[model samples]
Target: MIFLFRIGFLEVSWVDIIDIALVSVLLYQVYKLIRGSIAVNIFLGILALYLVYLIVRAAQMELLATILGQFMGVGVLAMIILFQPEIRKFLLVIGRGTEFRENLFKSIAQWRNSYHEDVNVNEIMEAVKTLKATRTGALIVFSRDVELKFYVETGDVLDATVSKRLLLSIFNKNSPLHDGAVIIYKGKIKAARCVLPVSENDHLPPHFGLRHRSAIGMSENTATLVMVVSEETGRVILARNGIYLRGLKLKQIEQKIVEYLQNTEPANWEEISEEEPTTTEN
Candidate 1:
């Protein structure tokens, strides 16, 4: 390595600068991935502890340093276990390439729109509108490019057709299936009362309830669209890929759903009504 400068006893070289720059970039990316989540707090706490350990050791505090050194020895493994989900997500992005994943989902959406022809966007919109008016809390998950069987098994399997009346009845406060989430795939309700993972992102609005947190978590883990209706505020929210869109109107919700499911603009209700119904079973 070519020496660039000398700071007292330390020699700084071109390779050292490049190495430091690469490390800084890697740390920044990791910070971005864990920001707004509980993991970031944990990460900072660990970092602070490590700094304390170093200070104590330099001060010749042998007893405290010995204990802290033991913990620091396993720090790499501990971090791996602590940030497993974030690490997996980071690896997934690197392996698949963000553009490739987006294009793949778009192609799938286009194919589903052309062949399935059974989503009944009008019914879904009507159901959501009615739920919004009634201030009924609801969580609807639309699966795409990911298999949600693990989460689906956490609830009651319905395997029923999607209809406004069915959706309304299921979400009715008095209904047994009113709690948890309703999973929809291939334009059918595959499960009800499905317990979805809750997000650990502390930056989510304080007003967001468990339903919204679960929606965000599910979207964060899978390539899925989640819809949330607030019971207290009568607001409609959409979540996808860990991002949330709040205060959506009926038309806006419809447009978002269409774009997510079909990668196209909202379709005419008349044409949707003309299409034949499609059915499937789990």
Candidate 2:
């Protein structure tokens, strides 16, 4: 290797600098993905062990290096098993932001999108208000860019118009469809009684029930804004991209939903949410 400079007997090259930069970038990306979750501790432990392995190998400690080397051999598979959720999220974020996806979306846009009128945000707010008033637990997912067909197929398809009465009826406690979620896409009620993935986040407050967990989980895995009406406290919660704003005023929630449907949310939403505490209605 071409040496740039030396410290005692060690030399560093441009190639080594470039390699370290790339590895640092990759590790930083991984850290960003799992920063607030439980997996962060596991990731740090693994990183510390790997650093020790490198140190041992560099010092020519044969026995310790050999043992650590064995662990490194299976590191790829171990990381896959341990960080499955984070890996999936990383891949999904990549897929969503890729030029291929953008081009694909443009091409697909040419084939569909004939609907002219927009879904009334006020109507949804009204439905949510009624649900809250009745203390009926409900989960509603709204998507503007990506149609959540995968999760939609998990329950009954409605393809009905968005209305206050319809939402109220579907979420009526005695109604058979009340047990699951409702998905609204492109100004229409795309589906009802949809099943959503439940979040395993340990940091979530215990007061959050299954409905809240499912809403958070759904938002975490997809490009969707989820609203939850608590059956216990009759409070409203909004989740998007893994961050939540719980117990906000109905008007505030309505405004956020409107922004979401308009695809006008501020960039790096999770970052903003992390820096600001949730505001509750007085």
Candidate 3:
């Protein structure tokens, strides 16, 4: 049997292809806006309730259908109330786009140059190595997308160049700023002793300490890179995009830093250390 090809429709309507493509793009954007957010769950719940209402109507259950129909009538208002935060966030993003268009491209180009600069990574690596060797506790947060200004304001504003000496001094055990995190932005230190939200995830390993927990919490909210050096064990841990890598060696940590700063996927940090003798403790 000869299959009738869609070439017949293609001859008549190129408009259909454009219409489908536009719809697909809109759906994808909508998904991107709502995915990994509370709105997605709320949307699914509403869909389920609507399905139940349809079933009730089909079954001719008048009382149930009437009740469901009433609820459905007010569902739009309920949804807006339930999703106020997400709706506000979406609107804020749209508003920012107008402002971002004025300066974003230039800023992105500048960031690109900084990412390729060897001085930045070298300075950071030296700091990490020294901090690890001395068993100095430190939390370093690299910001992305979400602004850390609120937390940055909580700490001393450094606005200084990123260098080994500065980083070392800031996190030195005896330093006044040793307790909190240092926020890094655009190849420089933005703030010192910045407080970070601690992760309350029940599934996190019990052995993970405060620094790791805080790093994970910050990562869960933003696409930021966080590095933590344990005071007790000197174990270097990395948290990014809600995943944690523990017991990273100096080299592995540097690689991860470069990868993250350059917007590339970090290599397997734990695997990178496998060639050497694994130390149970830092």
Best by lDDT: 2
lDDT tens readout by residue for model 1, 3-67: 99999999999999989976765565555456545576678899999999999999999999999
Ranking by TM-score: 2, 3, 1
Q: Model 3, range 1-282, lDDT digits (tens) per residue? A: 233346754443466666777676546544545543446767899999999999999999999999999999999899899878557755654577764443344344553454332338888888888887889898999764334555688899998889999999999888999889999887668899888878767888788888888988876655578888889888887876566777566777777777667656636433453344232221
lDDT of each: 0.77, 0.79, 0.73
In model 2, what is the error at residue 259, expressed in angstroms? 1.5
Candidate 3 least-lDDT 10 residues: 273-282
Task: Show where candidate 3 strays beyond 4 Å.
Answer: 1-119, 144-147, 266-282
Can you give the lDDT of residue 4 in candidate 1? 93
- Per-candidate TM-scores read 0.57, 0.62, 0.62
Candidate 2 lDDT, 88-166, residue by residue in tens: 8667656766633553444445535533346788889889888888898999998775556557888999999999999
The predicted structure with the larger lDDT, 2 or 3, is 2
How many clashes does each candidate structure show, in the order listed? 0, 0, 0
List the candidate 2 regions with Cα displacement exceeding 4 Å: 1-117, 268-282
Worst 10 contiguous positions by lDDT, candidate 2: 273-282
- Model 3 scores a C-alpha lDDT of 0.73
